[model samples]
Structure formats: structure tokens, C-alpha cells
Target: MNGLTNVSRRSTQLLRRSLHTSAALRDAAPAGQTLRRTGLYDLHKENGATMVGFAGFDMPLKYEGSTPVESHHHVRKEAGLFDVGHMVQSMFRGPTAAQFLEHLTPSSLATGLKPYQSTLSVLLNPTGGIIDDTVITKHTESSFYVVTNAGRRDVDLPWFEQKLKEWNTTELAKKEGGVEMEVMEDWGLVALQGPKAAAHLQSLTSHDLTTIPFGRSAFISVSSSSSSSAADTHLLHVARGGYTGEDGFEISLPPSTTTLLTQLLLSSSPTVQLAGLAARDSLRLEAGMCLYGNDLDETTSPVEAGLSWVIGKERRSEGAGFVGESEILRQLKEGVERRRVGVVSEGAPARQGAKLVDLKTEEEIGTITSGIPSPTLGKNVAMGYINARTHEGLHRKGSEVGVVVRGKMRKGVVTPMPFVKPNYFRG
Candidate 1:
């Protein structure tokens, strides 16, 4: 075998050995109450991960030897893998499923989105508030795969249950088989992200990675480079999109093979380190992607979050019969009172709940929703909502502003979002 393949084999061997220990597996879960554990819990601990509780799961926040910023920069320059299995994954399948789901969001899932394509959409409440931001993938006309933030699980699950019951009980249920919601509990989801991510992952599968462009997906068989596991290929649902705004793939596979698959990905020549939640937060913020609880909530609407594009063009014109069509349409025509925007400041990094003031008047006009010291730009980058009525036309790009950090006003500007330019692969 070639030297590169040999290195991969050895890496996989080490991973398998480290992951099989019962002590690590047992200790990975918290002692008192039952927090959730992904299939890779033991493997994360084996790699010297710093564990933290998030969204009711024991998750790795960062790994030894790499700070969150270091991991963030690595993902931008090369590649990194993230365990995102804690997020809720679910399937909506049965006849008329598309019609049923379309009632929950303004996305044109039943018509506009092609089979195998995905869209970043929001779950809307009756008042046009965002219930959650979710990625919805159409497997067929009647089968869809959805992923939503784990932090919103308490809210999302009940919404799904109630809505599913309403739709399944309607007349549509008698003519076509009612839609069924099946939670993919314990399924494994990982993102292989960065510029080199595609090339790195290409070595494992015979499927032409090029065919799966951004927002598209395909089921492909992948095997570890190790000779012992080469023949045991596992089928994975690979979607070519990510929260980081980098060109990447989110692979979903059975829980049983989560560790093996992760090891297999890490075993690629030149290697990609395992990144955790902290790095992911900064990366996604740099990418200008919204974190459900931070940048969005039941009190916010997609329009106010600068995600109006998520509303389908045709759906809008036709008055999409979705949950909050009236309120959203009113906002679309008349405009929102406040809108989400990017802010870059000259002082300390702004964190959530930071107040924003008009620099000239020293009047509070907005609030920071998310922020970080951008590793790529070396600046304090933030996302926030600024009220138009409070400071008319003052939140436009380059408008002078002051972000209140630690009770001190720091000079800043209303910078256009995606603090870092996106590198999403269109091809």
C-alpha cells in the first residue's frame, strides 16, 4: 500500500482502539442527571476533548493543544470536522408530507425546491415570529429531512407534535396518507468543512463529489482507508452545505458507525483536527449564519433577521398559506421596524445583550444578538438588530455607532453582514 494510505490505516487503528474503552464511554455522560450523548461521545473524550453541557448533551467545547481561535483559523485555511449530532434530525414522510410542511414555513418546498436540494428555512409562528431556523432537504416529493437547533428542542418538538396532529387530522389525511414525523434520535451528523473539505472527502467515496453542488445531497457509500474496514462501506446521506458558510458537506449516518466514520474522515492524508462547539460558534458568526437562540427566537421574524430571502419568491406572491403569511407579507411590503445587521467595533468584542447607541447622540437604539473577536479579521465582529424608528437610516452600512461593551462605549460601524466573505462553492 502507498505511504498515504498506510498513514490513514494507522490513524483509523488508533481511533478504534481508543474508542473501545468502557471507562471513557461510561464517564462521557454526566453523573447526576441524564444529558444526551451522541454516538461519538467516547471518541471525543479519547481525543482529549474538553467536554461541556450544551443543549442537553455532553459535547466537546474544544480540544487540548488548540484554542478556539486556533481551531477557527484552521477551518478557514484548511479543513476541520465537527460533531453536530446533538441537533435534532427528523424525517417527514408519507403522502402529502410536502403540503403539510409547507403550512409550517413559507419555503416553497412542494414546488420550487428540487428533489435532493435543501434550503435554510424558518419555522414561523402565527404572528410571524420565528419558531426556529432549520435546514430542510427534499428527498422526494413526499419525504423530507429536517435539522433544527438542539437548543430549541423543547420548543420545536412540541410545535412539531401539535402541527402534525392538526394536519394529519384534516381532510387531507383521508385522501392521501397523513404525514408522519419520525425523529432520527441518536443519529449521527458531522460537518467536514473548509476549502479543502471536498478534496479530502473525495478520496473515500467512488461517487463523484462534484455532482453534489451546494444545497444538494446524495446518498453515497464510504469506507475507511484502513485495509480491515475497506470492504465494509456504509451508506451516508451527504448534503453539500454547512452553517459555517464554507464549502463543505454535512454527512448523516447510522448511530452505530458514527465513530468509525469520524475516524475515517480524520484519517485523510494531511489530517483534519476535531473542532468543538466554541470554534463552531465563532466560525458560524464570521460566516454571518444565525444561531437560533442568539440571533433568532419566537419574538423575531425572518425579515427582521435579514433572512427574508428564505421566503420563496413564488410563495410570497401567491400569499403562501403558511403559518404567518399575513404578518410576514405586511412586513415585506411595509418593512420591519428593526432589522438585523453586522457591526464591527474598535474595542472589546461585544457579547449578546450588549446595547447599541448612536455615537453622535449617545442614545440607545439597538441590541447585540451575537458577537466575537473574529480570528480571521482580528476585529470585534457582531450581529445585532437596530430599530429604524429609533434612529432612522442610521443603521445603514458605514453609519457611525457605539457598541456598549463592559459599560464603555466603543466606536463601531454598521458593517454589512457576512463579516468575512463567504467561500461557498457554487459548482
Candidate 2:
């Protein structure tokens, strides 16, 4: 405990120095307009986090004593805790809840997923464009727990309200029951990510973490003797997966216990330091995960974004299904003009909006949606769309490409993602 305390104090003390400082990095909240906060906001300040505006919330961009690279590598090596309470958590319940979700997403949620299994799915617009990527956990056939990106709150909530109303007026709703959405507002969410995450969290719960595989969740009771975050016992939702492509859990607990729960997790081990958005972004990018605003949008389809796997093969085989089934089926039948792929560029790391050009023709093929110098690989890795259909073999793996950084073309190669192998524990 002494070591943890010393690390915390030194972290905050150096946070005052603002390593790799940004004008936006400050201790105080951003001015101009009111910003929302998670239940763990107080805990973040106590731990010496440098807060910044993100997804309409005052979130920690990074903590002291560790730069983005340092924190990124820390989570890769050991466990790190993250406050993700700003994400919109919600529940859908009714006799027709499963049917409603299947309509909203392309996943065969109602039929394919067994109880308590979670799938990474995408909400779609009418024309097969991605509305937002989401994780939907089917608690039961008639119930679900969902987590969507906080940045899409404005678009998602309204879409839900409109869709629910429309669905309720249908013959299906009259025959079965109208689905209802219960938004889990102000709920506390934290992700414990790393290869060691499970071992640390295992000490606090009697429920065997070994039985809980990746893409599954369980309601478990947690306790900490040195902490008073919750009562003597607390039942929380522990989803055994995370954004970092590592074995971890995204635990959702009551808002009141947010800070104490975080403290409790920190109390469990010395290495489980608090990480921030800076590390989260780079880690996810390295994991080959999509950022909603950067890699996905209202204009991009799952087929084009290389996320067709998110759509169950069974569903894709049935053409007359889903909201945008027609377009999605058409794309699957006839290929898309472009595909999202990985690129390892030379000279410099590609940035968002960086042009992807053909190696032979130097013609613009696509744009880099996300990129970073991978801490694990020590190489410039990126994800971008490639539209070199006419120049056959250009988008294929091992083919040379170019990522235009500044005005010069940096040689790159079409590579298989994730740049770093995911360490998800299957057993």
C-alpha cells in the first residue's frame, strides 16, 4: 500500500509539471460551457489526472508520471483501470426486445446469441451506413444490456426514441408487446484492461473468473476490506472483454459506488494504475479497433469498413432481413469499391485523413482513418480504406502502398491487423 500511495503522489506531483504538456491540459474543468462528468470524476482528480473535453464530458486525457506511450505499454504489460462512465448504458426489455434489436442491428441477435453472450454490433441507417458501433449483451431473449459510444448520445437516443415509437405501432408490437428502452443514466462503468486484469479482479470476487470466457458476462459480487466504496457486498455487471484487445472486464456498477469501486480495484494491486484517453486512443488504434467518428460514420457501411464479420453469416445469407438488408446483401453479392485495411507505413506514422495512394500509379486510393506509432511493435501502423479496385492486387496483403504524409509519399505495405496480436483469454 505504501508503494501505491507513493506512486499516486509522485504521479500527481509530476502531473503539475505536465509532461508532454498541451495548452488544453489543465487541472481545472474547461470553461465556456458546462461539461458532463462521470461518477468517477472526483476519483480522477484525486488521482492527479489531467482532464480535457472529450465526447461532451470532462474526461482524463492522461495521468501524471506517464506519457501516452508509457501508459499504453503499461496496460500491455500489466493491468490499468479506466473510467468509462460517460458511455451511454441502456437496457431494452419487453416480449419483443430481441426482435427490436435485430431490426436495429444486422446481427442475428434474437436467434444466434445464447443467453448472457455479448457481440460487437453496429447500428445502421436505412442505406446500410453505420449509425454507431455498439456492444449488445443479450441477458435473455426478452432482455438486453447495451453500451454505446458517448460521442453518439445525441444521434443514438433520438434514433432509439423514433425507432421504438415506429416499432410499437407495428402489427408485431400488437401481437407480442412493445419494446421499451431503459437508459441506465449516470451508471458507473470502468474497464480493467491488460493481461493481468483478470488475476487482479479475481481476488475481489468469489465467482470463478475462469468460467467466464471472453464475450460473456456475469453478475458478480465484489468486496474490498481496505475500501468502503460500497456496502459489505455489491452486485455488479462484469463483462469479460475490453477495447484494448486484451483480456479484461468492463464492469458496470452503481453510480454511488463508482469512486470507491475504483479505489478498491487500485487497492487490489500495485500495477493497476489509472489510464486516460490518450492511452486509450493509441491502445485501441493499435488493437485495430474502430473509433466511431474516425473510422466509422453515417456514410460508411459495415461491408466497406471491413466489419462484415460483425454481421452474422446466417443473417448475411438471408437477403430479406435487417433495416438495410437490401443494400448490405447487394454489397456482399457484388464487392464494395473500397475496404478498410491495415497499413504499415515507413518514414512517419499516418494520421487521420492522410491520403492512401497506389504504389505503382500514385493515385489516391483511400484515406487513413486512424494511425499511431505502436508502442508494442515500434512501427508506424494505421487503418484506412483502400479503393484500388481498378489496380487489382494493390489492396492485397504484401502489396506495396504509399501513405502521403505532408506532401511526400511514404512507402507502406498492406498488412494484416491487429498490428499487435490480441491476448484475449479464450478458456
Candidate 3:
């Protein structure tokens, strides 16, 4: 059978057996709870998207005309637009804003991050477990913009609010400057991703796209052709980074200008088609990016998740004293019981919760957290955790293991990831 046909048949079988629960299903809106809609809800519906409940919101799973595999491949080879407006955006300001943020996350925000630069960070509990993964940008020394996962709103928002109140009332904050946070409600965020993204986006604005290197951001004016009473141009906050491991930009702007901006991006090139959650999932997985509820949670530590790079060198030496620093430092110095790793398996594709066993003993050692048939690699790729002791000896590339799929053992090997090389535009 062809790749698409094989994938379709396996997906059907997996769905029928309920072998793996989706991240969307895991975080679906509670019964009797109303689902929220992003600013682009009408546009998504107009485009014939398949809507599903995700993170307490009605989100498009995929466009009706495109399969997940097709959308995934399209984004890898060309460019694709994704509506990610459901994510929470907030602005923190005040003289003590940087200091306040420094105490909340493990990243060296106060020392390492420069103005207009962004860093991927994790909110931590006091015990050093992850609260949520977030992208924080330093707009200024005293001003910041943060974007966090939509599914983490319930936990993240309350934590930020409580911390802000506490920090504002603290003696040090009073001696310095107090901090305040503003949630950017009803805003819009769209990700334009792939190899050709920069060339297409450069045509929309006068700003030299080449100067805004990876992990940096800029505010650029976007000209629109939509001849409504609305302004002919609008300023948007565009960041040069994305989850897809591609050269891309994530544009954030007011709700009123979202549809026009999206239209402009789509019309920029023939390759820029609309993508949705299904494609987003597979792309991120191939990029080795973690999905919050699936690959990370309140119980997981950054060191164990292979995110140790997020901890700054200065923080490690000077003990930056962020929340969970003690346990995190301990883990960094000693080691974790298990470490997350990538896997490539033969036979059927392993799904989340599939048992990973030792090939020789057939003993369960770990479980698959995320898995998919990669469009870029044309192989079954997965991310999971293996016992650190076993990982040291047997988790190298080409080391054979067993992944239990529907009670059958499938041959698999521990492999290095991003399964596909990342095409980030660093320059």
C-alpha cells in the first residue's frame, strides 16, 4: 500500500481500538462548559475546517480538503499558515518586571535575554516540576511579552496573577518598582512556517527581514489590500521563531486586523496554504518539540525532558535562585531516573502510552509519550522516556528495543532527533 493509504488504515485501526488518546481529547472542554472561539473562528469555518474542542476552545483540526500528512509535508517543503490565536498572550510592565519574571522561571531572563529577543522557558513549581512551557520576549528591560499554551491558561494565569500580587506587595518590589500584568484578550496570532517563509513575509513589510534573526522579534507595519473602512496598514508584533523547526515567523496583532493579515499571507505565495491542529501536532513531533500535556506536565522536570539547555550557564553557577532551583540543580548535578529520547520503530507506529520494553528481557522500561508516521522521514517516529541506566547502555542510535503496539512487540531503535534537520534562520 502507498504511504497515505497505510497511514489511513493504521489510523482507523488505532481509533477503533482507542490505542492512543489525542492531546486535544485529553484537554477537551469539560461537559456543560462553553467552548471559546478565537478571532479567526468565522474565517476557519468559511474555509471548511474540521472544528474540534481543544483546550476549552473550538479549534480547527484540519482543513476539509487536506489530509494531516499532506499538510505536514506542505509545511516542510514550502510554507503554511496556522491559526494559533487560542494561545494566551500577556504583557508585563513596570520597573521590576524583569526581576519578577526572573523569580518565576528557570531561564536567565534578567541577565541573558536582550531587548526584542525571545527565549523558551518553563514555569516551575516550588518542587522543580514544570508548570508550563512558555515563550517570553523582552520588549524592554521593564516591559515584556509572554505567550503560553492555551491548555495551560487555567494554571498559568492564576499563577501569574497570584505572583504579581505578591511581588507588587513585597518590600523589594516597593523599594524597586512594582510590576503589573495585562492580558491581551481577543488578540490574534498566526504562524507562517517553512523554508520559503522569510521570502514571502519580506514582501509584506518594509522592515529588513534578514536583520531579525532567529529568537528575535520586531514590530512591523503590515499593508493590507482589503478595502474596508479599517486602516490600510496595521502594526504587528512579529517574532522570528516557531515550533515547526522551520524558518518562520509568528505574527501577533489586534483582532480587527487578523483576517486581512491572514489573507495577505495566504496570497503572498501559492505554497502558503492553511494548516490546522492535526498538521501542527505531527510537525511539532517531527521537530522534537514537546506537547505540554503529552510530553510534559507538572510532574516532569526540564533536565529529564532534555531541556537542560534552557537553563543558563550563569544560573547554574550562581544559583539564579528561581523557583525549583534546588531540585533542578540537584537533578542537573546528579541525574534523572529516566530521560526523554527519540525512537524509530519497524512494523506499526507506536502511539502514546505504548509500552517500551527491553528487547532481550521483554520487560517494560518506559512508555511512548508521542508518536506518528513522519511525512518528512517516511518512518514511524516517537518520543518517550527510558530508564537512565538502560538509556546509557542501550539508548544509542541503532540500539534495538521493542515497542508494544496493541499487545504485539514491534522492533524499534533509539534514534537521535529532530528526525529531520531544523531549518531555523539564525541569521
Candidate 4:
């Protein structure tokens, strides 16, 4: 449960050290040929999307209209559907699936999870480093659903395969009835996010969305007259979770039914708009969420990234059988040297790698990982790292610290996280 990349906080240091060359450099070298597209690619283009290469896919970074406009369109009055098909989707089926997953992550999945509930988890390398962050949803005792980052697919798949082979040969894994992994490579996934998302989605289903809390999912059918092929044929799986810091759902459907569902969802609620990566970034930032490449990597740990809460108390004591138990436990008790924190600046917004300097001595205390002018808060908000004990010495509510905004230093203050309050539906 402790392995999400602190993209907004931790990745800043890694990215600054690694990708300082070009802003347009795509991470995963070309897939050898043309980039891949989601099921809604043509539909997005028809809507005047400004596509950019991301990971190994050509994705919509923004629309011809602009990003702020698209963001406001979602926050103020309606909803926005984002295509996230680039993510890796898979299903694990076996009598011992739960046990197998428990072996990989530190979560007390056997006790903490209920059927149809999803929890965040980290895949750990043997050396106590994070392989990837993932979401695992328990469908039943014998079946589980997992989603991982698209950029890590090549590395992730081989790791899973090799582990599966080892487990299949072992005695414990044999008792687990032999695991079967299915990679749904071409599946279509869309995130319908915003305050009005539920209202708009309600018109498409008879199911009571109010009963479905955040971090939970259900398989149901959505009917529409404008649907291309069938009326109510597609069996849809919807998870009530999102990165936008709003109450919303991520829907998985058939690729052919993608256009129809998107069109109907957009038209069904005149309030819902098509939001792209631009709005997605700002919204998640305001929410204090991490982007994998930018926020987290193998070099960082949960305690350092400000996510120790994901580690369960029982697991801390009983041991969840994950890879990084010893070092993570040590850090949990002893603490790390640096901790991720949120900062509020007075002058220009601090960009990545902007050194945080002490106003008195002007010595570098830390560096900004992610910073921007928050659309909701109307302040320059940033997430960064500072020396755990010395941080109090450098900046505070009354004291002034310098953030290297451009070439010159600007004034800033230490701030708390979630610039915007998260609207997670616990009910």
C-alpha cells in the first residue's frame, strides 16, 4: 500500500537530475513505429484536441480552446471525461490470488479489504526499491483487478511474469492453485470527474451511485439510444475514484462502445465537457496528488514522500511479507533525513528544482518539486523537500525564505498540503 510515486513532490529531484535536456522529450523511446492511440483518439481529434506524445501514446494535452477554460468548465458547473486508456489493466484469477498479492505489497489485504473495494499498493523490488505503484480491486476471493502505469508496462510485465513463474514452481504458490494473469492490452478506460459527474452519470444507470463510496467499484450496464452498436449490451465496470480531488468515477468499457459512451455521457449532461491532460495536471496538483514519473521512483520511499499512512498498523507489526520491510520499518521508527512538504510563495511561482534558501544565510535547504499558481486557491502553491529538523529554522509563517523562481530568488512560506480540499465521498 505504500508505493505510489510522489510525482508532484519526490519526482522533482529525480527529474531535475535526469531530464534537464528537453521539455518535449517523451520518456519511453518510440515503440519502434507510430505512437499508440486510445479508443477515443479519433473522437478527441474531431473535438479539436491538441495531441502530444506521452509515454508511448499520442494523447491530448489540451484543446484548441485552452486549458484554464477546460479546467473551469469542469470545476464550476459540470463534468469532464478524461481518456486514461494508456494505463495498464490486468486481472488476476486463482484460488490464492489474495495471498499472492499480499506477498507483493505491504497492505493487510486479507483483513482490510471488502469485496469490490480498491486499495493503493506498491510493487517492491527485491532490494527494497519500488517497482511501481498500483491499484488492486478485489472482485471475489478468486479474482482480483489491477491497474498499473502505462510507462512501466515493459518493465512491469516481465517482472510479473518472472515472479509468477517462480511462484508457480514453489510449494506455497502451488497450494495457491497456480496464478493466471491476463493483460487487457486494448481496453478502453475513461475518467468522468467533477462535482456534477455523479448527476450526469446517474441519468445513464439505474444503480444508486450514492451507495457506491469512493475507492469502490461495480460492474453494471449503461444504456443509451445514441450508442453505436448496442443499446444496453456493454458490461461496464465503474470505480468511484479519481485524481481530480473531486467525487467521480472511472469507467471501463468495450473499445467499440467507447465513442458512443463518451458522446452520450457528454451530451447526456450538457454540463459535462471533454477535459484533457492540461486540466488533469492542474487539478491533481491542487489536490496534492502525484504523477508517477515526476513524483515517485525507485530511489524514493513512502516515509520520505509523506505517504506513511498507507502502511497499515497491523502490517507494521505482523509484517505483510513485502520486499522493503526491514528498511521501511527502520525509517518508520527512526524517520528519514528529508520530508516532502507543501510551500506557498509570495512572488513568481517556483518551478521544479528551484532551490529553497534560508533568508538569513542564503544557504540551500531544499528544492521545489512541483509548483504552480493554483486556479482554486489563487496562490503560488508548491510541493518540495526540506531537511526534517532544519526546515523549521529556514522558513515559517513569519519568516521569509527565497525560492529561485527565475534566475533571482523570491519570497516564500512553508504551507500545508491539498491547496484545495478533497471531496472524497465517504458515504
Candidate 5:
């Protein structure tokens, strides 16, 4: 069998084994409780999508006919559409909006980011623990757009409200107009990802996609020949960035226009398949992106997660006064006890909760948080944390290690991440 076929078969076996062995890996839908749905819920269902509960919403896990491996390969070779509207979209507006956001994140939003530019940032707690990861886009000096993970809604929303109220009452806000936070309810966010994503999306809009560049966004008008209301084209906020480590765009538009726009994109080319969560997971893993609840949490600090690059140089040099600055700066100077790293192993796939041990001594060092058989690489790839002090000399790439899989120690190695090269479009 070919690699895709072999991986697909192995994936089936792994799923069956996971369901029986791990409760955390089972369906998230609560018994007798209704799960929320996104704007594209019905569309997904009509297209033979298998829905499952994720982050309190019923989302597409995969389609009925194609395997996840096939979907993953399709995205790498061509293009795919994904429904990511479950993420929280919010607007921060006011004269001091940029300053207010800078206080919440370590990124230098006030000085480093120009209008239309975006940065990946983390919201830190008072103790330097990560509250949530977010993407903040600068629309103007007084206006900003931010998208945060849906799983962190309960923790993130209330925190934002409390902080906004406190900041508005401060003396700084009294001099400059106070900041206002507005959640964009029911907005539809879709990600068109793959190597050909730019060409596919460019065919539908008049705005030059090349001008947006990676980490930048623009408001553009989309026209489709399939639409009856061609004259009344819809305005879309298109950001040229995604989690798949591919050249793509995350298009946010009004909820009413979502279905029509999706259909138009699908019709644009046969390669534009609708991918689901299953493919999304593997693609992001290969891209070395961290999933919120899996690789990050309130107890995990950005410095330890190997995400210190997200901290702006200006912020580190001149102190931005962001939340958790003291603890984060201290960690930067002194270093952390444990750090996240990538692991590649042979034999059965190492699922979450698998323990990592010293290759020769068999001493437990850490636990795996995320793992999968990479469809592209056809190898068991995982990410976990290890004691930085204990594995100090052995932390470099190619160091031999062992992962406890099914109660047996399996051979593994410390490897550099982004197992597959990222294809982000810089221009």
C-alpha cells in the first residue's frame, strides 16, 4: 500500500485503540446536553461531515468518504477550506486602545506593529502564566481586532471585562478616552489554506492579495459570478495567516454571507475541499503550532513553551509594563525548569499521557501532551515537556530518548520541530 493508504489504516487502528484506552480521547459531547453549533453547522452536515463536540461546540471532525490522511495530503498539495468561526472575535476601540492591549500582552503593540499588521501574542496572568494565546491585528491607532481561542471563552471574556472596567477608571484613561471592548457575535471566520490558497482567493476579490503579505490584513470586496447580488458585493476582512503553516488567508465576513462565500470558494476549484478538525490537528502538528488546551494553559508560561520569540524586542529592552512582566522577565534571565520539545519515535504511536524517560537509565522525565502519526511524514510525532536541568546536555536534536507506550519503553529522539517546512507567503 502507498504511504497515505498505510497511514490511513493505521489511523483507524489508533482511533479504535484510543477510544478504548483513553477517556480524554473520547467524544467531548456531554450526555443529555445540547451542544452549540457554528454558522456553517448545517452546511457541514449536508456535506456528509461527521460532527463531534469540541470546545463546547459541535464541529466537523471529518467527512464521511475521505480519510483524514487524504484530507491532510490534499491540503499540502492543493487547497482546503476550514470553519474556524468558533473562535472569539473581538474589537477593541478607543484612543488608548493600543496602550490598553499592550498592558495585557507582552508584544509591543504600541510601537512594533503598524496599521494593518498583526502579531501572535499571549495573555499572561499576574504570575506570568499564559492565560490564552491570541492574534491581535492593528486596524488603526485607536482600533484593533483580536481573535482568541474558543476553549478559553469563560476565562478570557470575564477577564477582559474586568480589565476594561479597571483601565477605564484609571487616570490615564481619564486623560485619553477610555477603551471599549466589543465582541463580534456570530461573525463567520473561515480559513482557506494550502500552497495555492493565494491564487484561489485572489480570483474572487479585486484587492491585490500580494499586497496583504503574511501577518497583515485588509478589508476587501468579494465578487462571485455565481451570486445573484453581484452588484451588492460583500465586504470581507481578510488576514493572510493561518495555523496550517501554509500560504493562506483567514477571511472574516458577516454571518449572512458565510454559506454563499464558502460555496463560491469551493466552486472555484476542485482542490478546495472542506477539511475538518481531524486534518486540522495533524496539519498544525506538522507545522509546530501549539494547540491551546493541549500544549498551553494557565500554568504554562510562554518562556517555557519555546514561544519567547513572540515577545517583542522593544518590550524586552524597555519593559512594556504588561501583565506578568516581572515573572516572565525573571524566567528570561534565570531560565525555566521544564521546556516543551518535539519527539519522533518508532513502533506504535505515543498518545498523550505517555511518559518520557532517559534512554539508558529509564528515569521518568516528563509526559507527552500531544502525539500523532504524522500523515505527511508517516512517523509517530509528539510534543512534550522535559526537565530542562535533568536533560540539559541531551536536549539538543538527535539526542536519544525513550517514551513509555503501552507500558513498554519505545525508542525516540529529540528532533527539531516543523517536521514539514512551512510555506508562508511573505509577499
Candidate 6:
């Protein structure tokens, strides 16, 4: 749901008309600049969109209706289509690409990933701080498809280049040779997320969509009849992975075919509505997923963020030898200083930056990272961190805690995440 950046009070009114800025401009600005538009920006304008500043792009916050109305539209019948082109998409093609990537993240990419399969990974600093959370998709042994947050575009791209240079200069990869890297900047990506997403996408391709299991992707050609671009289009990658807790796919299409593909998918696909940031935020919160800026930042580590699972069991012992391995591997054996957990508040939503206080000591233990009244769960849910032992002290199994919500303390309980069941497709 990351959209256009630097929206001014004046330009908010211009969203219903047309926009001229491109996505790249949006990424480069932080102030109330004219703002850049995505390929679907005009389509959103035509659909009566109320655009808002998000991430770095001017993206539609909602279209033709209120947020609650759009939220209900998605949860009930079919699906929702999200234009996530503002996200940074890149390709890593080199003989030592896997090894180079392994040097940046802690995940055991060489073992856990298969061709076209993807896994969530964390880029770590030398001290184990999370540089950024990313999705690493394996296209082959020597090539990788990566998608990261737009908010981190400034930090992420330079980090990758610096690391690539250092990796290429390393004795191991240099001695072997045949290793290189490239970043695909002109790609357009869309996410079709919800229960009926698979069915909707299936109508366009003859490939066995079912054969592409969850966490896996495939390359397929999409036939188009629009005048925007070519007749038949090729989707470079389609993965059964998503931000919302639903059976969905993230489609990476060529830049020129973006508008045509979107038009085709929206017009032909039933049970799918164009969704924006508001609903996407609610959906990700309900699914117990973390947002990079709010839930994770450069100050937080994977262990403290409850992402230890991304580290392979063997790597925790033998070590995959990535950046911050010294600290991350140490925490893998011993526990972390703080642990992220889910909290169920009784009254109002305990939003991010809200303090978590111990009922007895009245001490501020941690801060809320993400929270919302889950439309699906019909209650207030929040995720945050607390002193690792404090989490145990407050809620050993069925104990309760207190959270500061709306300037007042409210009763809450420690609970497992995904307050609603995740509907990710395993097959």
C-alpha cells in the first residue's frame, strides 16, 4: 500500500483529475513536491480516487467510497487488487549471486529456496540491526528476484551496490569469477490479494497456476487486447505470496504492459476490487505482519522482531556467515533483549508509539509498533515488543497485561499473532 510521496494540502484535491509525475520522481522527493504517479495513476483518477501521500508516491487511499465501505467490499465477496509498483524491484544475476546475497542476510537461502520459490529475509548491519526487510525469490541458482520497501529505497539500493562491490572483490568469488549483478528498475509489480485472486488470475493464462505453490513463482505470457502496449504480454514473475493473509499472487510485469495488464485484469477479473493503503494496512495488521517503518527499523534486529524463523536451524549452529552473524548467531542460542508479541486491548486501538506498562510496577516496558481494530477479528489487536522476561511475567499462558490506549490505560492480554487465521496457500 506504499504510494506517492510528498502530497501537499493543495494537491490532495488534484487526485480526482490527472497526474503527470512518474514513480521515479516520487521516490526521489521527500517534501511537498509535485509528486510522481504510477502507471495506474491515471486509472485511479478515472475511478474517482482520493489520492494520498504514502511511502514516496501519490497513491489512491480509497476510490469512489469511504474506507470502511472499501474494506467491507474486499472482506466479503471476491478479492482486491493493489498496485504496488512503488516498491523497489530488482534482479540479481551472477554466478555468485547466491553467495553474495548470503553475505547480506541471515536466511539460509542456499538451502531453503528452490527455483521460483521465495522467502522473507532481513538485511542486517554488522551489529545485527535490521537494515531492511525483503523478499528474496530464487529464479535460478545464479539469479535472484528481490522486492523491498519504497521507504527504504534510498538506503537499500546503495547498500546493495556497496555490498556487491565488496563481495565481488572477495577472494572466494573473485577467484571463481563468472559472478555479476544487475538491478531491474523499470519493472512494474502488482499484487492480487484475497480469496478469489488465484481464480481471477487463472482466467488469463493456460499454465497450470495450481502447480505454482505458495512461496513459489513462474514466468508466463499474458495475452492483451488493449492499445496501450503489445498484444501478448509476459509476466516475468508470479509468486503465490502476499502482504494480506490470503491466497494471492504478486505479479511482476513489464513496464510498458503495466497499464494494459492492469486494465485487462480489472475488467476481466470478477470478485476483485482496486484496494488502496487504508484497507491494506488493516489487512496486514490483522495478518500479524510487520511494516518496515513502524514495526521494523534499522534499530531493531530479527530476533527482537520475532523473525528468528528466517534463520535456518543449521545456520544457527554452523553459521551461514552473513553480516552481523556474530551477534545474530549469539542471540539465536541465547534469547534476545526484547521480544515482539501480540496484544489484545479491551477498548480503543493502541496505536504505534503507545507505551506498554506493567500493571504492577507501572513501568514502561515497550512501545506498540502496529495496532488496529481488526475488521476480521472484530476486536482491538496490536503488536509490539517488551522485555523478554516481562512477556513471560505478564503472560505465562493466560495472564493479562495493561496498555496505554488513548491517554488511558486499558486491559489487554498477551496472545498469539494472526488474530485471524492466515489463509496462505500451501500448495
Q: What would the per-residue lDDT of candidate 4 be over residues 60-123, giving only the tens digit for each residue? A: 8666654543354455346788899988999998877877777777776767789999988887
Tens-digit lDDT track for model 5 on 1-427?
Answer: 5985775777855643432233222434457766778899989999999887777678887887877777888899999999998899999999999999989999878788999999999999999899999999999999999999877787899999999999999899999899999999988899999999988888887788989999999999888664759665878999999999999999996878888888888888887999988888888888888888778878899998999988888787536689999988889889998888899998988877899999888988888877888878878898888888867855668888899998999999988898889999996
lDDT of 3 by residue, 1-427 (tens): 5986877655534332221266655667877899999988998999999888888888887787777677878899999999999999999999989889988988888779999999999999998899999999999999999999898898899999999888899888999889989999999999999999999998877899999999999999778854543468778899999989999999997977778788889999887999988788888988999988888988899998999989888888545868899999999988888888899998888888999999989988898998887777878899998886755666566778899998999999999888888999888
TM-score of each: 0.90, 0.91, 0.94, 0.89, 0.95, 0.89
Better of 3 and 6 by TM-score: 3
Residues forming the 10-long window of minimal summed lDDT in candidate 6: 13-22
> For model 6, what is the alpha-carbon lDDT of residue 418?
76
- Model 1 worst lDDT run, 10 consecutive residues: 15-24
Off by over 4 Å in 4: 1-25, 31-33, 69-73, 226-231, 389-400
lDDT per residue for candidate 2 within 12-65, as digits (tens), equals 333323222222223123357578899988888887898977777889977877
- C-alpha lDDT of all candidate models, in order: 0.84, 0.84, 0.86, 0.75, 0.86, 0.76
Give all candidate RMSDs, comma-separated. Answer: 7.9, 5.3, 2.4, 6.5, 2.3, 6.3
The lowest-lDDT stretch of 10 consecutive residues in candidate 5 is 16-25
Candidate 4 lDDT (Cα, 0 to 1): 0.75
Looking at candidate 1, what is the lDDT of residue 127?
98
Report the candidate with higher TM-score, 2 versus 6: 2
After superposing candidate 6 on the true structure, give the runs of residues whose Cα lies further than 4 Å from its correct spot. Answer: 1-29, 32-34, 66-69, 72-76, 226-230, 233-235, 390-392, 395-397
lDDT for each residue of candidate 1 in 1-427, tens digit (9 for 90 to 100): 5985564444333222222221223244445767788899998999899887676678887788776667777899899999999989999999989988889999889888899999999999999999888999999998999999886787899999999988988887878889989999889999999999999999988899999999999999887654547468788999998978789999997888888888889988565889887778778888898876677888999999889998888888645689999999999998888989999998776777889998888999999888776767867788989998668987798898899988999998999978889888888
